[model samples]
Target: MTARHRFDPTILREYDIRGVVGITLCEADAHAIGRSFATVVLREGGRRIVVGCDGRLSSPMLEKALVAGLTASGADVVRIGLGPTPMLYYAEASATDIDAGIQITGSHNPRDHNGFKFVLHGHPFFGAAIQNLGVMAAAGDWEEGAGTCEDRPVLAAYVNRLLEGLAGVDPARLAALRIGWDAGNGAAGPALERLTARLPGEHHLLFTDVDGHFPNHHPDPTIEANLADLKALVAREKLDFGVAFDGDADRIGAVDAGGRVIWGDQLIAIFAEDILRRQPGATIVADVKASRTLFDAIARQGGHPVMGSSGHSLVKAKMKEIDAGLGGEMSGHVFFADDYYGFDDGLYAAVRLMAATVRLDRTLAQLRDAMPETFSTPELRFPVDRARKFAAVGEVHARLAKAGAQVVDIDGVRVTTPDGWWLLRASNTQDMLTARAESDTREGLERLIGEIDAQLALSGLSRA
Candidate 1:
């Protein structure tokens, strides 16, 4: 029998397979992904694969179908059951027998959305690899045979491993600190609950129940609005700091005791300072969208700062290539290869954040306060025709080049001016154009935004 399938074009993205569940994605797509991915694994002379799912309402259904497909394609499936995306990454990275892994999750997307993130042989499986799944499925190119599936709950082990991140911190310092955590009612809730119970200090938790409805707020931590509950909790408790997780617990958001949100780049700066102190002169990679302040901070700390593209997968690959001890995206995906596995784990990051603060002998708020101040707009995203997004960025890049403007063309056009820097990039995951500007002063920041606006206007588009 011949088996063939085709995914909605939108679902086969650069980094993962994702879409609105009933609309662009469905059980059939999940099955196809599993079958096709298994073929890829089998062809690579591997058969063991790990699978997991998030707290999304549809995740169980998708996971079942995916497992059936994997087994049908002759791939042994080790089901890790429900958990955050990083737990799946952990299973794949730590297990000596597993050849690849997949996590059914929506990540930071809305409740109605769902997706799959893949790791093959401990490395991110994305970009061309993701697209190739579609190609193979459409062509009915899949292996065949009856394989086996088994359940292995690793949530406790994963939580214990996260505790290791705080291994070297002084117990007295940790016991004295007060912290708040918000799981955003996502897949990370259970893990967060278990983790805090074992940690020292006064711990306050919010929305740690795995509610797929997300009754409190959206799960995305990158949006300031999503962190309102966490901010409020931090302010009310007068805690040392607060940390929040996205839908799948791969990205992290933080707020100081003053209830001030710490943007991803700023978090990177703090982490870099701590990492550099231990690994002196180690390489730290930050996505290009990060503030120049972060880059400068790393360099000032005697670390090598390398700017890479924005996606987590891309950043991870870049980090591996350059042997970077730490890497992060401005969107809150932080990776630490210094003392732990080189993967983005929000729960792990929270632990490390505390360790960093204690080891530095500073309060989280104090560390945040010491950072150089700068004004910047949050990442602005507006829709553009999928085909037009890249072209528009290219047009802006050419114009900036002809004008003799200093630009970093790594992932897009980030034009540097005496006042500040403005970035215009086409988002790889969506049909959207993203822009950001930063400067040392409010006036300079406004001017940088104007430059972005002008470039967009020239491209026959305007910021909304």
Candidate 2:
């Protein structure tokens, strides 16, 4: 008998498979994903698959079902147990025996949400690849055999690899720093605990206990509200700086000694300075949503700056294409191929940030203070009809093109005006239209935002 499964249409996102657990996604879906993915792997002449899960309560059940599907398809499964998404990436990237990897994580989403992220043959498996899984599952197009599953813990090795980001830093300067970390009770907790134990400095950790309910706060560090705890921790401890991680610990958020939230692009600028110093004229990539200031900073340092489409997987693909030494996003997904593998790892970013501070001989706050001042709106996401979101952006793009506005449409429409810039793009993961604007003056920022509003209004929508 052939086995066929149908996924909830909404779960097949552009970057990964995600949905609200028990509602739109379930154990059966996990099984189908495993079976389908394993079939693809077998077709590619690969048999070994690595899997890991986050701290979510539903992860264990999904992992069990997923493994069953994989093994049924004759794919050998190596389960890395519980850890951050990067740990799964690390296992796959470092192991010669591994052919592909998947991480069961909800990322920075709400507690009830859960999903899977994948890497195959050292490349991101997403977009069309993700959609094909659904097609294969619905057709029951899977190989059959009884393969085996085994557990191999990689947390220790993963932590050690993260420490390598600081390999050349002076131990004395590192020890002189005082830092704070907020894991937000995500999968990074255990790894953070282990890394901090070996790191030099006075470290204060918040929400390191893995709690699926996220009793204290949500794990999304990009949101200002979510960083309240981290900010308070830094202020109370008088630490040099603080770093935070999202649910699966792939995205990062930070605060300096004065407790100001350092946005993602600003962090890239800091990293770019150090990296360009070592590898001059190297290409540095940043997503379209990043500030113009960051692009100029990279260029000023004699580094080539490339604007990438937003989304971690897309940025990673672009980085690989351009052979970029560093890449990042406004959402805090930083990738480093200079001293480490080109993947977004929050823990590794933290270590590199520390090393940068030590080598530059400047406080984190000082590095932040040196960035050009620009007033910008945070990512403004508003719900739109799933079918209409992309259309709306297209309409805006066409209108802007007709108007002869300076536009960069690498991902969406980023209008570069005399003020600064404004971006309008559809969210790849959700049925929402995301917008952002920046400028040197408050008045200019308002005008840029007004332009965004006008464009959205023309598309029969409004930020309100």
Candidate 3:
């Protein structure tokens, strides 16, 4: 009989398993996750599972333990070694025989934090499925057998597929475009380095070395501070545009020629315009946090616009339901189901962005300039008690309903006014309430902010 272990309940999250290393997550927890996940896979008639890890310092040890647990449960393990989370997703999607994939990545979290992202038969394995794994582990109900393990090299092939996005792009225009890429010393560094080496034109890359410590800067690109280096490189090198990837390279961030940062919604707008040109009336989805301009832009391009809940898993699931061509989040997670797998891949998004620019025959800066100017507050997140968070959102929802506001409450409350729109949603992954408001003018924007603040006060909470 094998010894069964229990994990800290908090580590099992809504979308994936994540917790601080050593304190909340450890090698033992990794082993239990493997055991439980493998049992579920085998019961579903799966025998082979693909596993990958990021460049984190603790990943290799956890990977070894996880494989041990998987094989112990009689599931064959195919280890792809260290790479970005999306690379593991690519491996699973491209491989016909693989039943599932597990990528051990921290994913833009602090260095001390680590987690697991799963895909079972190309669909996200999360929410209730994640909770069930915990239940199975605590009961020590994993299957018993000795399974096989092997290593495979798929990086070169994956990189080649990414380059295929430029297939129809004008060669001369692509060759004329100079781009800068920053990997932020995360798991995607090596892959990004290889990608830029093969891409057309002069490609300047920064922090392409895999460093778990993230000595240069934090791996998250959603924050403006993290893009300073990439922006400077673009300016100094006079590059046409720049791209940045998060820790596991699932999220993308970019800067135009003038060093102006293009938020995730803006990038999706650009993608929607180009994609709609080819695939007329395709559906484009963006999370509720996205700007109104993005939705309007997609509609103007003859594409259906969908406002999805925030989170990669939610966005991906919604995309599948609607058969959308493209979907993305304000957090930089972009998914493309048009000509590729419906998974967020920062490196792939960057390549596609470049292809879009070349195919559209416009400079990135010029395309950005053409968009309507809307004053908006950056996404504002404030800490709230986990137990009280949902209750607070409920209170706000009731208030808005009593007031008869035009609100979309699929995931949260997105209220619309004559000026523009404002969103207040409780984050799925954290004990935080996030709010964003946008308007055509400063006065309208201020009014929207005031409304958000008033709602928060009604819920006995105030922005910090």
Candidate 4:
């Protein structure tokens, strides 16, 4: 007999499940996921699933339907209300009673998109687990029992935890701090509003309201143009610092008081150094796309630095594997296990940055200046047919042997040379090819970029 209700497996991804709402993922799919997840959790002996959602117009409805499925499958539900992805992660990691959680979000995806992030037993639940959920949902094999669903202000408690972790930053030091927060019209907008109220300073806000339409700009700060408002506000207001968040506020980007971008690598580098101070000889992991400056800084601070593949799920998995005190991606997902539960939270990261700034008693510009200097290219994106990007990378990999380049293929290919390193990789979340090059000198960086360009051209792709 055919399966009772089969959820599509194509949408099940390596990290989280995402697709264009109504097209690939609808209320029916959400309900199936809830039932599937409930079955899995029950089989694994879990009784509850912490549920949350972002500001996307589709999120609330999805959460409701998913909860219905969860209750049908004999799993209790704890609703944390609407907030950033990290708040969902925080609430899951904060309490020992909750065994699994799911955040209904689209993250940095376009407005037409929505998805779910799942965590089971304090680890990111993905890959095969997601596929299995689909199978169970389709089979209609989920169990049935009486289940409880509760509503509570988990956001306030989450904010309090962040404040406690950043208690070192005295209110006096913050008085002179004029800050700008670009919420990017995502789940973090509301949370940022509440968190900023506690700090002692004049805080400028942008897109702090929850608008799934994202009226101001796309919610992703990783794209440089999306950061325009924050940069301009900093420049015009002479602000002490500026912070921006991706759709869910799990990833963070910063601008110095001078309006210069403090990229993910640099921001995490600062946090890594502070973490090492607290626990010497600690292990800290950063994705391969991260800058060498971060690795060197971590080593200098007597910490073990690990380079791993890129992807939020991959990094989070590695963090648990190594018992790493911290881990981050160049895309701005920074996980802190030092004093917190070791998940990326833009608000928490911002607080720690504030503390770091105050502890050093230096302006944000001065702190950024304390790091080593190097010439680097911004992450450049070029469209590649989804089917061809991987093949192109494989083609380039095959050619690497004849070229005699130090090709490191952890994420894609990172050709290291005496003067610099250049990377060419396919975006895990999109049908695009991305490249970045860094060097101690500008000439070296140029040469590296030329090599990547030539390689892409040779692979039958054109640079954007």
What TM-score, over all chains together, does every model reach? 0.99, 0.99, 0.98, 0.93
Q: Candidate 4 versus the native: TM-score?
A: 0.93
Model 4 alpha-carbon miss at residue 337, Å: 0.8
lDDT of 2 by residue, 51-108 (tens): 9999999999999999999999999999999999999999999999999999999999
- lDDT by residue for model 4 (305-342), tens: 99988888888889989899989989999888877887
Q: Quick one: ranking by TM-score, best first?
A: 2, 1, 3, 4
Off by over 4 Å in 1: none
Clashing pairs in 1: none
TM-score of 1: 0.99
- Among residues 3 or more apart in sequence or in different chains, the pairs in candidate 2 whose N, CA or C atoms overlap within 3 Å are none
Which order, best to worst by lDDT?
A: 2, 3, 1, 4
Runs in model 4 with CA error above 4 Å? 1-3, 6-10, 138-141, 401-404
Model 3 Cα lDDT, one tens digit per residue, 184-300? 999998888888888889999899899999999999999999999999999999999999999999999999999999999999999999999999999989999999889988998
State the C-alpha lDDT per candidate. Answer: 0.92, 0.95, 0.93, 0.87
Candidate 3 wrong stretches, greater than 4 Å: none
Better of 2 and 3 by lDDT: 2
